[model samples]
Target: MNSEQRMKSEVEIWKRKMMKKSGMMNRITKKAQDKINGLIPEKAHKVITESIKKMVQATLFGSEYLTKPKETYNLSLEEKEALIKDSLNKFRKTAVVEGAGTGAGGLLLGLADFPLLLSIKMKFLFEVASIHGYDVKAYEERLFILYVFQLAFSSEEHKKNVLETISHWDEVKGELVDVDWQVLQQEYRDYIDFVKMLQLVPGIGAIVGAYANYNLLDQLGETAINAYRIRAFNRNEITEEIPLDSDK
Candidate 1:
């Protein structure tokens, strides 16, 4: 086909992927909602929204899927691996120099907000996979974690400030410097648990950040934590909100 035909064909394919008319898309949306409900925190609603926007923006600009989603070429396993590795390394280079910034142009996985510093980095990952793509989840998770850490790790320029900030939680009263290593590690462990949960669903690893977008910031913000804890504590008052169509 000509360039025009190819471009049109790619757009058609993207429309199919973005369209939610089919029940196929409904399942994805439901999963997204469930993830949101499971994760939404009262405090950091803005964080989640920004994160999703970053994810979508980053995917659109940084990923070939948005520009040439339909383009395909035969590559050996090694070649594909090399491509992913290269993309990941480039992203890491920035972190090794500067620290967490907003994602999308600012894209790299925003780490400026979380006082506890919950971050993940999936560098050079391919676009969304399908039911068959679930087998490689661990690599994706590792990539995500490394991508975020690289921000903290490689930030040579802001090394002093980033380190100082990470060492203590800046509070309204004063800087809580000299952070407890144990607590920071615990924070990582907590976020890792959520990452593990994403692996159970096929094609979700790519969109794991997206799925977490609705819940992670809120949970970290402790906005819903209190309410949820209250509901847990007062079982008698719990209404058990359930979606009517969920059963169907």
Candidate 2:
């Protein structure tokens, strides 16, 4: 197979893997997360929800960390993937280090990890958007980033819904209303509750934090890349398969 064919195959494999039905473990975890959600105080939940909403809004509209969108139309799939892979690696390392530092600092610092890690994730997404040639300054494009974020951290059922929405974004973007921040915040909290809670523990928090953050970034990176691949494929930018060794 040629390079383009290989790339298409890789993307197909990723899509199938992402769409696969959740297994028994996933269901059990969902149930556990639901119960934990019930135990969290309403006040605490409200605070977190509002905090995340503001933080995300600021990041989406802010120019501080945004990069100039690349003109990848002239770049080959292989070249684009190389840039993406590099960005993902850099973000993964940053997340690991942030997780380790917060995890080692005890409860207060571990608590601090929520916003810190969030910023890292959002900034990484912005970079990914630019690399994929998506103009982040556009309102729809910023909304798309939220959908991608939701896809990465939401439950399996939510993931399926988000994937469908994003897959046909052009059709749905017009009628879309404001994002349901409440639902978004709740789902995110539940999804990470178990792992993050462990990161608050006194003894093993550091190790767990670093490990969890590393894997989280990896998962987000995969989702971002495949999500953009769907768009590229739809636009016919990645339709033709060339020889693996072809310079063109």
Q: Estimate each model's TM-score.
A: 0.24, 0.86
lDDT values for all models: 0.32, 0.79
Query: Which portions of model 1 miss their true places by more than 4 Å?
Result: 1-45, 48-50, 53-65, 69-72, 98-123, 126-248
- The lDDT of model 1 is 0.32
Off by over 4 Å in 2: 31-47, 237-248
RMSD (CA, Å), each prediction: 22.2, 5.5
Q: Candidate 1, 169: how far from true, in Å? A: 42
On residues 1-248, what C-alpha lDDT tens digit does candidate 2 reach at each position?
A: 98756767786676566666778988797787678767755754565677678756766677755778988878876688789889889988989999998898887788788888888888888888898788888878878888888888887678878888877777798877657777888778877877876787788999999999999999999898877777776667444532222122
Which digits, one per residue and each the tens of the lDDT, describe model 1 over residues 1-248?
A: 96434433443343233222337654565466557546634434445445434443443334322222213245432343344445444534433222222222121233332321222232222321111121223333222222223222221232233322322212211433222333333333333334433423344432443334334332222211121122222333424332112122
Q: Pick the candidate with the highest TM-score.
A: 2
Clash counts for all predictions: 15, 2
